[model samples]
Structure formats: structure tokens, C-alpha cells
Target: MLSTSTVVITSFRNVLALSVLIRVGLILYSEWHDARSLVKYTDVDYRVFTDAAQFLLHPGPGSGNRAQGPLGEGYGDPYTRETYRYTPLLALVVSPNDWLHRSFGKYLFAGCDILNGILIYNILLPQQTRSKATLYTALHLLNPMVFSISTRGSSEAVLSSFVLLTLYAALRDRWTWAAVMLGVCVHWKIYPAIYGFACIAALAGGGRQIRMMTLLKARRILWFGVLSVSTFALLTGGCYLVWGDPFVYESYLYHLHRLDHRHNFSPYFYLTYLTYPSPTVGNFTASTSDASISISWLNDILESPLTSFVPQMTLAIGSGLVFGYHLPKTHLPFTWFIQTTLFVVFNKVCTSQYFLWYLLFLPLILPRVTMSTTKAVLCISVWVGVQALWLSEAYRLEFLGVNVFYRLWIRGLVYVVGNCWVLVQLMQGYDYSYVTRKYVESK
Candidate 1:
């Protein structure tokens, strides 16, 4: 008879094959069904990426550009108005799209999605049963949202893969590799930098056993910090050399001071709407003559986009410090999830895609939690219900041309409150001791 291990291996191969087949089908459907029809399923961001790639391939002077994209420097074709708001490297990575099929980028991201599934399985295999590992891999691989985003040419899957790779490296005690990966991830998307403190603490031996000054002096910690910063600086500095100041402003600075007054899932939306010009209500500037003298000072404060970053960064950094110092290595994934949840919830701009940041770490921590199924369902319901509520109001505002900024902002508050409640429930049932014991048992 064949060995049980052989059977499990075969089953895993089968699962991976099935995932590839499913992704291929999704890619084909996205190209023909979505691309041809008026009802679009693919994200519009793909065009922006390709346009940037084309521009990079064929350099041109800045002239006759009208639609100043997020980059604010219209370097691409004058006719195309799409903006590319990422690093020059990302555009170069997808530059093949200009020559190859338009769906080339989608294929690339799909491959990353598959790689993420493999990484998920490997990360879990040592801690859980083979079947459990396979299940988690399948859950991530076959997830509709995950595949949908990847097939739509979003770089989120690629971003997520780098994050998982960092976690995988950290779990293996390859601190240097973890640091490098984390740095690359942050360069890819700025939010991953928040995990730096947790990573540093992990490298320096977390908990009260080590003094603060001693932790700072540890060689491994120093190397991790140095390599991470060096990697980020090298990549970003190199890009800046090529793309210059506009690249810096568009990619990094814009997001830092970004305040979209449009209808979105942010509690600060109404505040931004009141302070900035509203396209929804033509010729309406709430901060102008319409505003009373009593609240003019408040509007001035809100007018500065940096004002929102103060509270957001303070909360995010505080969470990182607490989790890094208090949590064990086994709890790092959960730590990241909570930190990301807080970051996204407290952000000046929250969107559906932002959910992927925390969702990437959710499966890693779920198997360790001692939560009951019913309670988990309740938490999920609350989370999704709040999103649905916000989306309904947002749809009315964006599509139906209704001015429901106040209602949408209120929904945003409810979403934030609901997410906090879910986090508390998850924390209560997390079984931190269980994870620590598992780590000890494994050792």
C-alpha cells in the first residue's frame, strides 16, 4: 500500500493543479467577457499601468499633457489620460504589455497568486495537519475576491505574496531575508512599513527578557534594520534618479497627503468634502461663503491633509510597538493582522481593496484561535454588513447622483466601530497561550 505521506503529497499536487486551471479560466473570462462587453469586470487601473509602461519604454518630453494623472507629470501619450501612480520599477516589470497580450500583467499577477497559495501551505504545514494546510491553501487560491482582483490586473496579489514571503522568512528565523522582503513590500505599497517594529522586536528577542537599550544594540536587529532601510532607500533612490521629483511626489507624497472628497468608505469623507471642492454638487465650496465664521478655524485645520495623518500614524505606530514588545513569535501573524486592521480602519481613505492587507494574514491566525464557529460567523456578519451598508449609500451618491455625503460618512463611522468590535472578539478568543505552547512543542 502507498504511504499516507505519498497520498497527502498527491492530493496537494491535485489541489495546486486545480487552482491553476481555475485561474486560467478566470483570466480568459476577464479578457473576452469583460473586455469586450460594456459591463466591465476588469479594473481600470490596468490601463494606467500599461500606459505608464509604454511611456517608460518610449521616453518623451513633458508637453501637451492635459489630464495630469496621479503622477501630476503627464509623460505618456497626450491622447491617453490614464495616470500611473506606482514606482517606475512596477511599470518596467509590466512593460511587456506593450508588445505582448494586454492580459500579460494579469497572467503575471495570477502566477503570484499561485505562489502565495504555495507559501500559505508551506507556512502552515509545520504547525497544522497536512489536510489543514491544503485547506488553507485552497481557501486562498480559490477565493473569488483574490482571483478577481488578480485577474483584474491589480498588484494586490503581488503585494500580498511579498508579505507572505516576509512572514515565511521570519518564521524560519531568516531575519535578514525577512527584512529585505519587508522593505521591498513597503516600496511596493507604503503600508507594509508599519510591520517594521514587529519585525525588529522579533529579531531582538521579544518580551521583557531583553532591555530596551540592549534590544536596540543587538546585532541581528541592527542588520535587519539596516538592510531594510538600505533596500528601501536603494530601490526608491534609484527610481528617483530616473523619474525624478514627480515620481516621489506622485507615488509616496500624494498618498501621504491624499484626501479624496469623493464618496468612499472613510469617516473623514464628510470632513474632506466640507473643506474641499465638491464635484458632486457643482460650484459648491463648503469652506467658502457658505461656511459660518464660527467654524472657519475648524475648516482651516481640516483643510490641511496632514491633519488626518497625525491621529492615524499615532494609533498605527502605538499598536505596532505594543504588539512587537508583548507578543511571542508565534503571535506575529496575528499581530500583523490586528495592526493592519487598525491601520486601515483609522486611515484617511479606506476602500475595498485595503481589506486585502489584513485578509492576507487572517488565515494564518484563524487556525490558532479558539473562537467558536457561531461567534466567528457573527463577527463576519457584522464586518460584511457594515461594508454593505456603506456601499449602498456610496452607490447612491456615485451612481444615482445623490448627495449623501453625510450619510456615507456616518456609515463609515459604523464600519469603524463594527471592525473594532470584531477585533476585540477575535482578541478575546485568539488563544495566545495556545500559540506559544505550540511553538514550544514544535521546538
Candidate 2:
């Protein structure tokens, strides 16, 4: 029989080889698909990056031709046209793609995804046997969501890579690196700031007695906090100095005013659609009426200040407190996952890509987590299945103009319930001894 060490070595080699093969296949497939031309498969957000780079590289003659200045001054679609919604750091990151083909951006994202897989593999090495570690790492590399996001040129993959590096650094007790990585991620996208409290708590050490007093007393925690704040201030202040108020407004303040009742998959979207159904629902012949109805619904939702804000604020605060309560009680990795998952789940905008934020952390904790195999399979299935159903509804509205508005609330409810179930299971942390027994028996 092969020794355990030899078996582990073999598994590691196999995982590395398979990871390369899968990534190469995805790259080739993306090239063949020509995602840049296909609107459905292509990432619309990527266009913003490339467009901003083009504008910066070659400025237009007059103000009219100055690439809309990131505030969508005269453009049709503010989101894409006023591409300054993101921090200038991302535009600078993608500027090189202007000289190369647009497809090169996709390649760069793919490479980052592969690097994330390696990071995950290394993080798992100390906790599990080599075979198990390799398998967990493969789960991240082979995830469909990861593949789709990386190939389509969404920067979530890059953001997630940085976030994972921060988590890994924290796990290794490298507080300074963790702080630096977290600052880098927050600069890329502000949402990662949600993890700030959890990082501080982790640095302060885990237990029931952990409090503000305890955290303040720890020299390492104080330094970490200082470095993190300094990093964020430097990056954001530099952007402000360079581009002025437009950079600040578009990058940070715009999100506060985002009311996407018409073209979004949030539960809030369904709530608005229910209150005001499109005319297309009743009269299929009136295709033009759909836009007017959607606009009316959006107007109502936005104009009534409390309609959307109240519920979102309530959920945000309530879920945040709950996650904070459990942060010190659970393991750091799982705590980080819970914190991120709750943010995505309860946020006003729950995009499909946002799921990647928590999903990337799942593999790191999978080996340490205890759960029945059956329940694990059920949770995974329902999570992906609900997303598929929502995608279908979105497709009907976007492509076919079917206006499946009436049943949207049902889908929203189902998605929320499924997410809650999975989250509960993860928090419970059931023993995996039975899962191991079942596997051995089957073998």
C-alpha cells in the first residue's frame, strides 16, 4: 500500500495539474466565445474600465467629448458612461489592456483567480491531510461562479483575491499584512469595509471576554487599526486631489443614491414591481408601455423616501449586530464568512456576483467545519438552484420582454429562505463524524 505521505504528494500534484487544465480550458473558451461582442455573456462593468482608460489615455478636444467625466453628464447609461463609480485604482489597473487586446483583461482576471486557488490551497495545508486540502482547493477553482466571473472580466475576482489574501494573513497571525491587504481591498471597493470590525476582533483574539477595552489594550490591534486607516486615507485622499469632487461623488456618494427598481434582482425590485405592474402584463401588444410603467414604479419607489430606505436600514443594522455578537465566539475564518454572507444577503442590492464574496471563504473553512453530508449537499444544491431560478426570471425580463413581474416576489422569498437555511446550518457547526463514517462505508 502507498504510504499516507505518498498519497498526499500524489493528490497535491493531481490538484495542481487539474487546476491548470481547467483554467486553460476557460481561457480558450472565453477567446472562442468572443465575450466582448456578446452583451449577455460579457461584463458591462468592464466596459467602464476600458472606456475610462481610453479617455484618460486619449482625452477629447472639448468638454463635450471628455468621456462624460464619470458623472454621466451627457451619456445614456450613467452606470457605464460615467464609469467613475469605481475608485480610480481599478481604472489604473486595467489601463494596460488598452495597448493590448480587450481580451487580455479577461486573461489577467483569470490569472488572479488561479492565484487565489493557490492561496486557498496553501491556507488549507496546515489543517487537513494533503488529499483533503487539495480537494477543498479544487472546490474553489472549479466553482461555476468563480469560472463565470473570472472569464467575463468582472473585478470581483480581483477584489476577492485580495480579500482572501487578507483572510490568509489573519489566519497566519500576520496582523500587519492583514491590515494592509484589507486596506487595499477597501480602496478597490468600499463594501469590504464591512469586514473591518471582524478583522479587528480577530486581531484582538477570540473569546467571550473580547471587548473594546481588550482590543484597545492590545498593541498589535492598535497598530493594525492605524495602518488600515492610514492606507485608506492616503488612497482616497490622493484620488480626491487628482480628480476633485467628481471622483469623490461618483466613487463613494453615488452608491447612496442607487435606486435600481427597474433593472435589478433585489427583493426591493420585486416589491416595487408588485406595487406597480407593467402595462405589458395586462396588454401584451403594448411593448412600449413597459418602459413607462417601469419608470413610474421607479419614481414611486425613489420619491417615497421611506419605502426602500427604512427596511434596508433595519435589516442592515439588525443583521450587523447579530453577526458582531457571534464574531468572537466562532473561529476567525468562519466568522469572516458569516460576516460577509450576512452583508450580501441583507444588502439593498444583492447581485449574483456578490455571492462570490462569501463563497471564496467557504473553501478555507470547509475542512474545519462540521456538518452532515446530506445537509451539506442540500444546502449547496438549494443555494445554486435558487440563483438559477432568479437568473431565468431576469432573462425573461431583459431578453424576451415577458415581464414575469407578478411571480418575482415568490422567487425573492424563496431565495431569501434558502440563504437563511444554509447560513443557519453553517452557524450550527454540526459534527462531521457521521459524514466520515458514511464515506468510509460507501467506499
Candidate 3:
């Protein structure tokens, strides 16, 4: 007799098989290069590997002088020193691991995957009814992206998993506990904090104001704000107090000005339209030896809104309009999802890592929140495919030529359309919803 779990486990195996194939190619290529030929560890794992290096674990003239990374030192020393930039509070929760990094660093990094996977699976399980939770957890466990995060020990996984818990708590009407999770998750990654607005939207739904006089007159928002601020203050202050600034702790902060980066497939890709002729790759590469070529889209994404911030004001107004209209209708937890995707798509820099930021949310979107589970999976899988294709060497051929990367362009268009499909699914009113509907109907 086949149990329901068996069937879902089988499906998970299928996804796992596909994931193995997708990665086997990369592994084979790496193996194809021997010790003499291999350059250095690149790909998403490099960042996580390096992020760990940046912490107290690294012992070279720094915290413990242990020398960071399993094989090397610092995020960018042999590579480049890009700081791990999150608000101060984030460094606190994982401080235990930070301390444990010296002896257990390798294992600590390994355990990050274990911890996150366990949390995501169990947290989402009860939310899904009628045998869906098992399937959901199995799929998550098998997702190549999840495997990738675990392998590198990406801290984004830590933050994203926390966000899921926060959302789950809110859905359960455990609002205070939800606040605790939100405050903490935001402390780690500012991106998920956008969900707070979603929570507010949830509160403000359907022809009614969400004004609980206690929430306002009692200064509930103010108190929460203070609590959040204090928690961050303590964590960041304490960590830096011990480990102190490692090195080159600025790249993450510098991103606001790093418009010219070729990574991140944002709308900035269009900048090539106006600037390619001036310093074409042929000439640019001739003059500069290493890493000379860059997509022209950088200037446009970074250039607009330079004058007195009118552009930002307009953007805020437009965003306000979207929220104001949608707040009364669409579920709010997803509102930030729409905002993040739109900005990433239309803006200038859409890095591969950025995809994980949203991928973490799909489980919430699936089986009930918006699209059918199959469609939700498909929507996510398409973007993942686009990324996988882009990461292959074949992309570097045509991509490195025109600066436009024709294949990537075509893929981008597909992504835009797919993105719109989900946005509409989430933005429009209807119920394939589980938690969101419960949140509204309860009030």
C-alpha cells in the first residue's frame, strides 16, 4: 500500500533527479579542470564561503588569525574583499555560531542548511492540509536552489527561513510572535522587511480601516519600533565589539553606487542602447586587461532620479497608489513580492542571488495563496531555468559579444511575462488562499 507520503516522496525524487543532472554538468566541468587548470571556487557558493570567511572564523591578522574559508582567507583577498553588509542586529542571533566558527566553522556552515531546511519544512507543514504539506516539504528539500544555498551556507537562507516563520506566525494570528520574527528577520536582511508593509496591508483589507485605537493611541507602533531598534543595537554592537571589523567591509554598502555591474539582469540592461558606441567592448577590452567588458545598462538605472529626488517622490507616490488600491483587495504578504520583482525586473541590477530572495517566498504562494501549486512551481522553475541557462558557459559566448547577451534578453522577456502572471494572480481578488483569507475573514 502506498502512503500519501510515499507519493510525495516519489515526486520529490523526480525533482531531485533533475537537480542532480543540472548540477552534474557544473561538477563535471569543474572536474574537467584538474588541480593545475582550476582557477578558484566561483558561483553562489563562493559568496557564502567568503561570508563565513569574513566573520570571526578568519584568523589572518584579524579576529582569530585562523584564516577564513575552508581553503583560503577572506571573501576577496585572493578574490575581492566584499563586506557582509546587514544591519547590526543580524550578527547577534548567529553569534553563537560565530563563536563556534573556529573549531566548528566548517560544520557550522554545514549545519546552516540542516537548520534552515528543518525550519522551512516544519513551519510550512501544518499550514498545508490534506497531504499537501508532505509534498511541499519534499519539494523544498530537493530544490537545487536549496541545495545550492546549503552547500555555500548562504546567510540569505537564514534570513529567508526566519521570514517564513514570521509569515506563518502572522497567519496563525500570533501577531506578537510574528512581530518578533519580523523584527529579527528584518535585522538580518532588509529586503524581507518589506513584508511589514504587507502585514499592514493585511490589516487594512476590504473597505475597512485597520485602525485599532490601541495600536495607535497606545503607541504600539512606536513601542515595536523601539524594541526592534534595541535588539539590533545590542547584537551588532556586541559582535563588532569582539570580532571587530574584519576587512574590506564595504562592497555591500557600495552597491547603491555600483550601477555599472554586469551581473543582475535588471532593466538597466537597456543602457547599452545609448552607451555601447562610445566605449565598445572591442576597444574597452583592448585597453583594459582583466574584467574590462561591462553591460551599458548600468548608467540608466543609476542615472535617473539624480535631480533633487523628484523621481523617487514620484515612485513613492505611485507605490502608494498601488498599495492604497490593493490594500483593500489583494493580500498583503505578497505585496512586497510584487514590488521586489517589479523593481528587480525594471531596475538595473538583477543578480542571480536576488532570485533566492523571492524563491524563499514561493512555498507561501503555492497550493493556496495565489496560483495553483503546479503553476506556482512552474513559475518559479522557469526563472530558475533562465538562471541555470545563463550560468552555463554557452551564455558567455554570445553574451560576451554584444554586451546585450541575446539569449539572456530573450530569457528576460520570458521572465517579465512570467512575473506578470504571478503578480496578477496575487494582486487580483479570489481565493486559492489559505492563511491570508483566514487573516482577513477573522477580523
Candidate 4:
């Protein structure tokens, strides 16, 4: 017969096991479901997949001008389907779509995500550290919102991996390598240029950047600047040799010039158009809440295609400078990176999967700090899930339905609450000189 103590411990163990299984199961479900959404046999996505596959093999790169639609009704659509905006150089990775089916590309992307997760944990871990960072990294991957990007074949995952590598190189004082890697990431998506600039600024802004390790001064500035500009130029120009027009090779840049429509994320544009539309079509009554009438002026501003992606450009520059200047070395880089991501998120016209670009860095950044294991994991997991919800709301509404929006908004609220909790914990740690016993014991 077992002792009473054994019974109590066994019962608690069972409860814990159940809770863990539920959590893991949810994460797996989230990943698989989001992935399956793109491959459903009876849907528009299947049609797109089928169309894209046919073009992948038959299309001749030698064709001078390609008609664009889905892209537009002009010389843009490369395949008579969607205007392919991605640089042809990236085709090395993306081009396999021509041989067989659309799912092939997506599966390759999924593999990249899993590999990325492993890379994150590997890089974040300290050989001789106080606590394991993998728990936190896994938490970040499981962030409630992150599922959207991981499973959808978004390029953000690849870009994010490059960014983390860039930052890691910089922290280790490998300036040249950092710039080269960052340039590659930026070419993937122009966003990483902001991060690269931040690294350069932190190295340059000697007065503001406290040197916990080395006192980097003006010399570092010149090297960083030269490397970034020169390497980026080389790759950008070189990419022309690989695909279409080097200049117009990337039609997406043109496509994104969305002076025509606006999402709520763009602060100035949306507020301006929502309150007083450009055509001055404000206060118009919708036939039904269900009937969607896109505010035309808002769409015009986004679709205008002028050199007017002002807020995004300005925010990228300002954030790179401001936070880069104020960034603390002892503070984990995740604190800084995550905050920058928030600025981008709140300030720009980001799509759903954009979070994957920054989220990948959390594993590397969080380990450098002194946070509890459970808290860290919870933060990242909810974050990934939240990203998934956000993506589903923006890009896959019919599949996830409106219910996912509730999850998206709730995840945001949870983030607010968690941040407050962190604030409280930080105060205790700084004021009293140690984290509370609750954090340590629970983890």
C-alpha cells in the first residue's frame, strides 16, 4: 500500500501531465490546421496552387515583358496569373513550384520553419548558463499568433533567421560578417535594413551606448556603413542577372505602394481617410454591417504607388536610431528587438505573417536575460498563437472564421497584461535587488 504522501504526489503529477499534453496538442493542432488551410482540395487556394504550378515550368525568363493580373491588367503579371514580384534570385529556393505542385513549395517552407526553430534554440542557448533558453525559445514559437507565418510559407521566417545571425555576429564583434548577413536579410524584405541600421547606430553612438564590453567609437561607424551599403548594392544589382528587370525585378515594391487602400495599422493614412475620406465620402451609411464598402480614398492612398511609403520609411529610420541609441547592453536584446517589432506593428501596414521575421530572434534574445522559465515560455507561446490569429484574420478569415479575431484581440490584451506583470516584476527586481521567490520557485 502507498503512503498518503505518495498518493498526493501522484495525483499532482497526473494533473501536470494532462495540462502539458493539452498545451502541446494545441500547438500541434495550430500548426497543422493553419498549414492544411492552404492545401484544402475544395477551395480558391487550391486553384491558385494549380495555376502557379503550371506557370512555374512553362514560363520563359527570356520573355521581355510579361502581362500582369491578379497582379494588374498590365505588363506586370509574369505568369498570366499573379504578378510575380519576388526577385528571381530567390527563385533558387522558390522555383521548385514549377516541377510538380504548389504544396511542394509550402512543405519546403514548413521544413524551413522547423529548422529555424531548431536553429533559434541552438543559437540562444549558452554553453554554461544559469537557465535553459530552449524553454523560452519554444514558448516564442508557440506564441499564439506565430502559427500563421510558420505554416503559410511566408518569407519572414527565412528573413528572421538572417537577422538573428546578423545580430549574433555583431554582439560577437564580427562587424563584416554581420553586415553581409544583414544585407541578405534586407534583400529578402527591406525591413531588416532598419535592424542593420540599429546595429550600426549602436556601434556609432558612443555617447549614448554604454560599453559593457568594448568602447566602440567612430571607426566602427565607417566600417559598418561601408559594409552595409557596398554589400547591399552588390547583391541588389547581382540579382538582376538571376531574374527579371533588376530595376523592376521586384514588382512587389511597386505593388505595396498602396496609396489606394489602407488598413487600420497605418496611423496617419487610416485616421485621415476614415474620418474624412479623400473623395470626401464620409458618413456614408452601409447597406449592412455585413456589406463591405472599402473606404475608397484610404485605398487610393495605399495604392497610389508614389514614393509615399513615408511612415514606414520614417519609422524604420527613427526606430533604428532612437532605440539603437538607448539600447542597453546588459539588458537582453529581445527586450529591444521585441519593442522595435511593436513599433513596426503598431506604426506600419504589416500583413499577418510579418511577426515571423522578428519572432525568430526571441530565442536568442531572451536567454541573455534573467526571466523565469515558465513565464518566458508562456510569453512566446501566446505570442506565436497570437500571430497565427492575426494572420488568419487578415489573410484566411473564411477558414478560421470570425472566431479567430476574438483570439487575435484577446492575445493582444494578454500581451498588455503580461507586460504589466513584467513591469511589476522588474520593479521588485530592481528596487529590492532580486526577483521574487514566486518566479524562481514556480519555474
Candidate 5:
């Protein structure tokens, strides 16, 4: 009979091999599909990423002429589906794709997916049994959504690596490394920075009674905050110096004020679509009674992307205040998971890829959640059911060329409400008292 250690080792090895096999198989399939068809199966974002990489590898005065960004600026061309919207540094990271295979970026992201799985396992190992740790890691590694996105050449897997690394470092009390990793995450995608407050709260010894002045004065908090801010500044500032205003606008500001009306998953999608200015019609809405019915005032009030920021900020800050402050380092993932979910739910522009922002932390959260098997399965089904409902409408709109805007909008509302209820259930099942007891024991 195999010893416990041997069993543990065998389990780890099996999961690791399974992870590699799954990712490689999907990566090859994606590459093959893309090569065989004019209508590629890989994300259009992959094309943009490769174009940006090619531009980086061969920098020339004419580089700007190759593609135009969403704003008609260079380095990304929406017409060709090459709209590079991420930081230029990401382009530089994948620049090797110029000489390497076009699938190189996919491989890179897949590798990060593997690394993220390892990180998640290590982060949980100290608090969980070896068997449970391995299972949780397998949950992340074998997650179909994660591997599919990475194999399609999306960078969310890479972003998740940094996110998990930051989480791991914070749990280990390596504030400097955590800060630096978080800075990289923010550089890769701006949304990850929303968890900064949670990290600070964790560092200052999370608890509701912890005074604001105490957090402000905590040396670790100060160091982590300063380093994260400085690292982000240096990276963005250096990129700005090299790439100029277009980089700044596309990578950062564009997302801040993004009002994308197409292929969105947010509840606000229809509103954005209706309010968005059209080149031919402009912002005017013609009423049946009047030829010139300017609803510009109403549009301005309801349509401003900044209006979404109010709720998003409220959720972000509120999550930190409520969960982050109360949870110890052991439970930080719960704080992050809730914060990201709320942010994406309320954001003016959301996409399917945005789901990964919170999904990466779900494994860490599950170990402490007290849901029954039936309840857990029910929650998962409801969450996935709403997504399927939205996707059915989306398929009609995108593929069938049918106008399902109202149906899609109604589905979006269902999606958001379903997700919120799921979150509530998850929170209710979480062992908050366990976290409190752990903290008290440590004290």
C-alpha cells in the first residue's frame, strides 16, 4: 500500500500532468483552427496582440502606419480586428512572437496558467490538507474557462499569475514583493488595482475596530502602498516616455472612460448603445411627434460612463471596509473575489473575459465556504444558467444578424441579479467566525 506522502506526491503529479496535457492540446487545436480558416477561432484580441508585438520587434517610423487603435491612432487597427488596448509593455513581453510562432503568446499565457495553479496550491497548502490543496489546485488548473481563454491568447492568465503571486506574497508577509507583483498586475490591466485598499487593510491587521489613523501610520501599509504606486508609476511613466500620448490614452484613460456599446456583457450595454453618438445621426433622438427631439440632456445624464463609476467606487471601497477590514490575511481572497465581482458587475463596459478577474480567487475562497454540496451545485447552475441565457441572445445578435438588443438587455439584467444573489449566498456560507477565531488565536 502507498504511504500518505506517496499518495500526495502521486496526486500532485497526476494533476500537473493533466494540466499540461489539457493546455497543450487546446493550444494546438486553437492554432490549427486559426491557420485553417480566414475567420479565426482565436480571439481578435490575439491578432491585435501579435500586431503590437510585431511593431515592437521592428520599430520603424512606418510602424504607426501598420495599424490604428480604437481611436484611429497607430499600433492597433479596428478594421482588421487588431485593436491593441493594453500597455505597450505587454506588447514588448510578447515581442518574440515576431520571430517565434504566432502561437507563442498562447503558450506564454498557458505557462502562466500553470504557474498560477501552482501559486494557488501553495497559497492554500499551509491552511489545508494536502489532498484538499491538490484538489483546489486542480480546480484552477483544469478550469475550462481559464485554459480556453489562455489558449485563445488572452492575457488574463498572465494577469492572474501576478494576482496570485501578490496574494501569496501578502499571505507570507512579504509586503515588498507583494506590492511589486500587484504593480505589475495593474500595469498589465488597470482593474487589479482596485484591490489595493484590501491589501493595505490586510497589512494593517484587518479588523473593523482598526482605526483609520492606525492604517495610515502602519509602516507595512505605507511601504506596500508606496512601492505599488511607485512601481506602477515607473512602468507607466517609462512607457509614456517611449510611446507618448497614444499609449497613455489607450492603455489607461480609455478604460477609465470606456463606453463600449458593442459585444458588452454589462447591464448598461443597451443604455450605452442607445446613448452612444452615431456618426450619421449624432446624439439626437427623433420623436414621433417632433422631427427634432433632442434628448441630449437625458442622454448626458444617463449615458455618461462616469455615472457607473459612482457605484463601482462605492462597491470597491465598501468591500474593503466591510470584508477586507474584517478578514485576516488567511481570508484575503474572499475580499478580493467580492471586490472584483462587484467592480465588473457595475462597470460601464464588461466582457466575458472580465469574469476571470474574480474566478481566479474562487479556489482560495471555497475551502472556507460552508455550503452544502447541493447548495453549491445549485449556485453554480444558476450562475451558469444566466450566462447561457445571455449567450443565447448574444449568438442571435452576433451570428444570426438578428436584433435581440432588448432580449439581450433583459438577459443582462438577469445575469447581474443572479450573480449578486449567488455572491450573497456564498458570503452567507463563508465561515466568517472561523476567520475571526483564527485571528484571535494568532493574537
Candidate 6:
């Protein structure tokens, strides 16, 4: 009879093989279904990506031509009318898909998911048993959000792969590599810039130290800042040189002034909607085209009394400083998880794709943390459950032509509450023993 260890290892290998096969099979199915459709029922963002790629490869004044101006007007093609808000790097990444079918991009994103799974497994190998690491990898591969986003060609998968790689580099004490990867991620999407502070905090040693040690820490932080900024400048500056101000305006500034009043997953959406309810069209309801509605209330909130900028900046900076200070006192992986989570929670927009930013890291940290399996499951379930409720209301409004703003607002409130509760649980359950021991040893 085989020993228990041998049997366990064999079983794990089988599970790993099966998981890969299933993921690949699902991806192929999605590609096939999308290809066979007469209308091509993929996400609109995918079409936007393809259109941007086409325009980049063949600049023209006809169909799929690039648009200009703040509203991104002046395009014959509706899809291409809105300028691509993502970095030029994403356009370059998707440019090759112009020759191939759109499903190819989805395939590439699926491949990214696979790569992320592998990275997660390897990242955990040093701190976790092979069996536990394998299980974590499987959990990541099987996550429903991962499947939904990757199959739909969302860039979150690619962005998340960069984030995991950055974390992996940081854990290995490869600060330069971490900085480079982070710069690349920030170029792809601006949100990952928050993690840079976490990286700096991780590198900065913990505890009240002597003046000389403080100086050394300051020097190291300065070095990291220079490397990261230089890397970011190289990538973005090159883009600026090539594409000029339009790229900068559309990619960066547009997001800053974005006024998305649509009923998405954001709690802020409810506040905006309640303050500035959408006007009813003849028989239809509030939609994107109904831009005639007055946004004076939102404008006032953003510009007067307290100014939205003040609170947003304060929350962002305050959270970063607090997390950075405590990061050295908590497990790196868990603290990174909380840092990303808090950033999303405090963001101006919290879409489903945004959740993918931190969900991919859940399995890697969950296995290493001290949180009980039951509580972890409960927390994840509640988080996902509230999101589902909000999505249902969104589907009703967007797809079924039903006006459910009231229901959506209620669900959004619940969703926000659920996220806050989960965040609290995560903080309470985080394992600080590693950092505590390190501090003790240093002293």
C-alpha cells in the first residue's frame, strides 16, 4: 500500500491536472460561443479595446477612427466615438488582435489567469505546504469572478498578473524588480500605485530605531521612490512623446472628471443618484443618453461647502499612511490584501472589475493567515452575496428595461455595509505574529 504522503501528493497532482483542463475547456467554450454569435455578445469594453487597437494600427478618418475632445465626440462608429481611457500600453498590447479575432484577446486574458495561478502557487511555496499551495492555486483558478472577467476579455486579469508578480518580487527582497513590476502595473492601470507605498513600507524596517538606522531606512525609501518614479516616467514619458497630450488627457484626466451617475456597484452612485435623480424619457427610464438631467447637485457637492476632492484625497492619503505604518507590524501578504481592499472601498468608483483587483490575491493570503476556515468562508460569501444582489438590480435596469433605482439603492447600501464588515473581520483576524517576532528578534 502507498504511504499517506504519496497518496496525498498523487491526489493533488490529479486535481491540478483536472483544474487546468476545466479552465481551458471553459475558455474554449466561451471563445467558440462568442465566435459563433451573429452579433458577438461580448462586453462593450472589449469592442472599445479592439476599436482602439484598429485605430492605432491604421489611423484613418472613417469607421473606427479615434475621437478627440473631453466628451470624445466626432466618430462615425459609436464604439470608437469614446476615446480609450486606458494607457497606451494596453492599446499596444491589444494591437495584434486587430489581425486576429476578438476572441483572441479573451484567450490572452485567460492565459493571464493561468499565469497568475502559477505565480500564486509559487509565491506561497516558501510559506505553505505543497498541498496547501496547490489548494490555493486551485481556489484562484476556480474563482467565479476570475472566470467571468477573463472570459469577457477584461484587462483586470492582465493587471492582476502584474500585481501578483510584483508581490512575489517584493517577498523575495527583489526591490528593484518589485518597483519595475509596480511601475508597469501602474502604467496599465493607475490604481496599483497605492501598492507602491506598501512596497516602501515593507522595505522600511519596523520598530523605533536609532538615528543611524532611521537614516538608512530613509535612504532605502528614497532609492525605491527614485527607481519607481524613473520607471514610470520612462514608460509614460515615452508614450507622451509618441502620442502627445491627447493620450495624457484621455487616459488620465478623463478619469479624474468622470461623472458616472449610472447605477453601478458603487455606494457613491446611490448618493449621486438620490441627489440628482435621472429624468424620465417619454416611456423609457434613466439611461446614459439622458444627459439632459441637471447635475448641479453633484457639482455643488464636488465644488462647494466641503469639496469632494478634500474628502477623497484625505481618505486616500490617510489610508495609505495608516496601512503603511501598520504593514510592518502585520503579515506582509495579509497587509497587502487589506491595503488593496481599503483602497477599493474608498475609491470613487467600485465596479465588478475593481473587485478582481484584490480577489485574485485572496487565495494566496487566505491559506497563510490565521483566520478560521469557517469565518473566512462566511466573509467571502457575504461579500459575494451582496455584490450579486447589486448586480441583479443592475441587470434589471440595464437589460430588462425595469426601473429599480430604489431597490438598487438599498442593495448598494447593504453591499457597502457588507464590505465594511468583511474589512473589519480581515483586520481583526490578520496574523501579526510574524512581524511581532521579527521586532522582538531585532531588539
lDDT, candidates in the order shown: 0.77, 0.67, 0.48, 0.48, 0.77, 0.68
Model 5 per-residue lDDT tens digits across residues 1-443: 98875565448777888888888998888878877988776887787888877665553455443333333334432222246778876776777777878788888999999898888877777777777888888778888888888888888887888888888777776778989998988888888887888888676656545556564548777888899999999887777656666777787787776767657778888777665566222223422342232477766777676678888888986787677666766788889999989998888878888898888888898888997889989999999999899998888878886666777889999999999999999999988765433323332
Error of 6 at 336 (Å): 2.3
Question: Model 2, residue 373: displacement in angstroms?
Answer: 2.7
Measured with C-alpha atoms, the lDDT of residue 23 in candidate 3 is 43
Stretches of candidate 4 exceeding 4 Å from the true structure = 1-57, 60-83, 100-102, 127-131, 141-148, 205-217, 241-252, 259-265, 268-316, 322-332, 335-339, 365-443
Per-residue alpha-carbon lDDT of candidate 2 for residues 349-382, written as tens digits (9 for 90 to 100): 6777787888888887677668778988998899
Per-residue error (Å), model 3, residue 284: 3.9
The best candidate by TM-score is 1
Query: lDDT score, residue 40, model 2?
Result: 52
Candidate 3: RMSD over Cα atoms? Answer: 7.9
Candidate 1 deviates by what RMSD?
Answer: 4.5
Task: Name the regions of candidate 3 deviating beyond 4 angstroms.
Answer: 3-110, 121-127, 172-177, 202-218, 236-252, 272-333, 369-394, 397-414, 426-443
Model 2 stretches with alpha carbons more than 4 Å out = 1-10, 35-41, 62-80, 208-219, 272-330, 430-443
Looking at candidate 3, what is the lDDT of residue 296?
39
Clashing pairs in 2: none
Candidates sorted on TM-score, descending: 1, 5, 6, 2, 3, 4
After the best TM-score superposition of candidate 6, give how far the Cα of residue 155 lies from its true spot, in angstroms.
Answer: 1.6
Off by over 4 Å in 1: 1-10, 61-82, 208-217, 278-290, 435-443
Show the lowest summed lDDT stretch of 10 residues, model 6: 70-79
Measured against the true structure, the TM-scores of the candidates, in listed sequence, are 0.88, 0.79, 0.64, 0.60, 0.88, 0.81
